[model samples]
Target: MRAGPLCLLLAVMSMATGAHAEESSPLSLSAGPQIIDLQQRLKESEHQRDELSKQLQNADADRESAQLSRLRQENQRLKLQLKEAQATAPQRLLTDQQQWFVTGGGVAMVALLCGIFASGWRRQRRQWLN
Candidate 1:
């Protein structure tokens, strides 16, 4: 019997507090002004971002144009240097030193072959005599 009365009392108290909360909630009057203020701030920030991006793009374009012209001038200079180098240099299959070395090698090979033939002839003659 005591538990039943205590539960009824708690229920009544909860209902009274709920009704009080509905009357005091802040969302009814303050939310509209706060939302408008936040929206205005967001718009201002977005406008600033757009303006900054446009300025950056213009600066980059100027820098790129200058760099492009410098690259072109460097390319032309290198081309002229290459043409001059090609025009002045001689094109040959072999240099003088390489030709001399090849000739010396051929002479040495011929001398070695002649020496072997002469030694073989001498040995054959001695064998026939014995």
Candidate 2:
């Protein structure tokens, strides 16, 4: 009868200890759907960050291209202004060699014209004058 009482007391103590152990057990924690939802939200946030980074990069490239175009236009306008300024300045017209060529061609043209007037077609006119 004493052995039976001792056995019953030991079994009750074991059951109480087991209940407390389960309450503090890490594996007994229950958040099955909550864990899956957290993971999915994290992935979506990462994808959004990646898309924002790409959009920022594209905007910077477009801004740089626009600035470069403006600089090119300004450079063209400056070149035109420089050309106009040069046109207003006094300038040496021609080199000595160019002047010689121009003068020589004019004399040649005059000689050719005189030769045409004094050629065989006008010999009779010269004889009649003589």
Candidate 3:
């Protein structure tokens, strides 16, 4: 019975040692076109990235041009509206805005002249004119 158990233990230890050796071994390299294939994949990825970058740049340029054109159109539309408003507004509005200060000055001068005339008449009455 002891011999049988010892033999079983030896077999188990041998299997464990073999498993550890396999775990520590390095993987063997392929000698075919694997390296060339990897390089081709890398180049393809680079080319794809370059193409995508160019496409993005083109999209951005198109977007910018569209924005510029839209702004220019809006500016033209606003100018048209301004011209139409000028044509439709009361013509007197411009005259009034431009000459309000002159109108106010004329009224002030008339009021001053009236006050002077009234005061002169009152003073002459007090002086007893023959």
Tens digits of lDDT, candidate 1, 1-130: 5999999999999999999999997776768998999999999999999999999999999999999999999999999999999999988888999999999999999999999987875655345555
Cα-lDDT of candidate 3 = 0.90
CA lDDT, every prediction?
Answer: 0.94, 0.91, 0.90
lDDT of 3 at 128: 58
lDDT of 2 by residue, 1-130 (tens): 5999999999999999999998997753468778889999999999999999999999999999999999999999999999999999889698889999999999999999888877845544335545
Q: For candidate 1, what is the lDDT? A: 0.94
In model 3, the Cα lDDT at residue 120 comes to: 75
TM-score of each: 0.57, 0.44, 0.50
* Residue pairs that clash (backbone atoms under 3 angstroms), model 2: none
If both were scored by TM-score, which would come out higher, candidate 1 or candidate 3?
1
| Displacement of the residue 8 alpha carbon in candidate 3, Å | 51
Q: Which should have the higher TM-score, number 2 or number 3?
A: 3
Give the Å shift of residue 127 in candidate 3: 14
TM-score of 2: 0.44
